[model samples]
Target: MTRGDDYVLGRGLADSVRLDAQHLLWKMHKGYELHPLIPRTDNMKIAEIGTGTGIWLFDIARQLPSSVQLHGFDISDNQYPSKELWPKNVSLGLLNSLIDPPAHLVGQYDVVHLRMWVPNIRGNDTSALIQHVKSLLKPGGYIQWEDADLVHQYVKGPKAQEFERRINKIFDKAGLDFRWVSDIPDRLTEKGFLVLESESGRFELDSIQECTKTYLLVLREYINGFKKLPDLDIQQMAKEEEIALDQLYLQYSHGIVYNWSPVSLLGRRDD
Candidate 1:
């Protein structure tokens, strides 16, 4: 089956828009594209796995020198930008990072980046997938990863908390586990990578109303995407989640939003 076939979230225009918006929101929250601790040199190569829309690379490109090569690989290229639109140094291709990278790409990049792969991580075990990513990195290369800390998601009232629980249940049905994001540093350390820094920040709705709404819209899109899946039970679960979210919104007419923390870490391959 194609990589897209295994993806629970449907690939569509709305999904693309969500990815792009989510990228900006994350950048705003984190305050930097590439971590400041990650040293940059001339002619450096960077790769972002599961690069939806290649938006992160495009944004990072503006901050780096034109000579720095940026590569984006995704399972599906449905959201990739057209030729001539992205930076000349930015190249995008199809490669499922969960699998062993091609020999030509082995130990090729100076740095590898991944974001929001929680759903894509099939099992609780990440050893094989971590090895796959390590194979793509050169000795002493860095891996910068960012993902939501859903395990610590919180809401104000009991109703809001119920909404969070129902949303998590949908994630569980989809075979997604947010707990893995918390273990990234340990996983990297086990693979002979030095865990340099691991940090997290909350997506506070009180601070940026627009960003908060965008995040909710992204979650709703996931529920909507589930409806498009081939499985009937999952579709029914999505229907229930949709109704729950709507009821929560109605109950709290002013606003009802859950806070999710995002974790980002920098690790380096031990030479």
Candidate 2:
């Protein structure tokens, strides 16, 4: 599909965007110690949900033994050139988790993985999503879910905490749930899967000014939706709040400060 202007994938960007995404992915992998998910055997099947930019799946296909099969699923159809460079074991497909599973994918994966789906999950009934994921897994297969809490619950600095609170309130006003991390484990357990492991960790960036910039740019499109709230002067306040957020980034650009505290929940389907 054509990369339209409104497309949200981190595509058609300056090099810094790519660098930041890679750095974040590397940090995520390190935080999770991801290697154990792959068994010693050469042949394996893995599925990655919300695989934006397709870089992480490509990296896995490159590093794993050639016999492994890596499939990337995203709502967008912007094919990656990196997939052409990989061995034939890699494939990309469209899998919108909010919709019913495609007929062919039902009960056909060894591992199902997802990352950075916080905003999207907020609009979803996660219990339903978990049940859908459970159906896709082969008996005894695993799932690795990683997402930022982004709710300021574990953030340290005062400025960063305030920024997170504003962002959280904005999302809340927009009717998005910012509490997915606190709720996902319970949803998984209720879906009849065995929670193999669940843990959370925090990372503070030298500056998340760039990250905030991207957020404000996107938030501009939705702020109008909040205009009708009686107590909230969203129309008058949005621009001022956005400007203040931008200024905060400017102050921290030599280092914009931000924190990412994500919860990693791993589960296995009953055999």
Candidate 3:
């Protein structure tokens, strides 16, 4: 995979800082995300899927009491914080959730959490993935997953529209439909988990939203990564983005409507 695809925004300190900022936005919108979803986790074991940089897990780890354990797993540990730097209760592992997880990891965690992993996981195979996550949890354990609906991402004005169209093309080529994230609640039900309802909020990457610049940075990464793909037409995409860049300049300067809302669902495995 290209370096551009390494951390979805390049594995750099700048990307890490941007992610931290984005985390604040999510926290502000979604709170800690787990407290309301699950009943408790005082001495519970927790695992995070697709843990990039492991920043979110680290933050949650710090808040958690000493008895609790926080684990994060991903295909790449390139951006993970040094072990020496991690809290004693927090750990990072190199594991891909899409593949068959190791037998030893089965039924280990009291909570299995995944956030913002829509770009990588296939919509058609989400059910199987959730089932696997369920396996990682103890009886009646909680699964708190959060992801945004991108298939219906909205942008206003012709200028913003053009920018979104190009980005959408790249996502389409990648076969990414993060909207399936919204269906996790139902999927958990089908998998025999007790669906626990909760609240969520929308994220608008426009002139008004605070994280617009962060979203722009991510868009740039997509442009760079898609350019390297063998099948996608880089020339056409770049040309469209050229116009889009100018359009975005004007759109974000004034006011534009670009909405990307997220949902957080809770599921409990039957004992």
TM-score of each: 0.90, 0.77, 0.86
lDDT of 2 by residue, 1-271 (tens): 1112222223344322553464355454455334475354577788876666666776666667888888878776554555567558878877677656787888888888876666565454676567667778888888887776665444435665676677666666656666666677888877777887787765434324444444444344334334444546555565556665666656544444455555677888875
> TM-score of model 1 relative to the true fold?
0.90
Which sections of candidate 3 miss by over 4 Å?
A: 1-9, 198-208, 232-235, 246-253
Candidate 1 per-residue lDDT over residues 1-271, each given as its tens digit: 1244477665688778878887877877878999888888989999998898999999999999999999999888888889789899999998877667889999999999998876676667777667877998999999999887778765566777777777777778777776888888988898999999998766655445444455566667778878987879989988988887776546553565566677889999995
Per-residue error for 231 in candidate 1, Å, reads 4.7
Error of 1 at 102 (Å): 0.5
Ranking of predictions according to TM-score: 1, 3, 2
If both were scored by lDDT, which would come out higher, candidate 1 or candidate 2? 1
- Residue 45, candidate 1: C-alpha displacement in angstroms: 0.6
Candidate 2's displacement at residue 117, Å, is 1.2
Better of 1 and 3 by lDDT: 1
Tens digit of per-residue lDDT, candidate 3, span 1-271? 1113343346577666766776776787665746564666578898988778887888877667888988898777777888899989888997767656799999999989887766566544586577678889999898887776666555667766767776777677665566666677777888888887644556643322655555666666666656666654764675568657655755664666655666777778985
Better of 2 and 3 by lDDT: 3
| Candidate No. with top TM-score | 1
Q: Candidate 2 — which residues are off by over 4 angstroms?
A: 1-38, 152-159, 204-236, 253-256
Clashing pairs in 1: none
RMSD of 1: 2.5
Kindly give the stretch of ten consecutive residues in candidate 1 with the minimal lDDT sum.
1-10
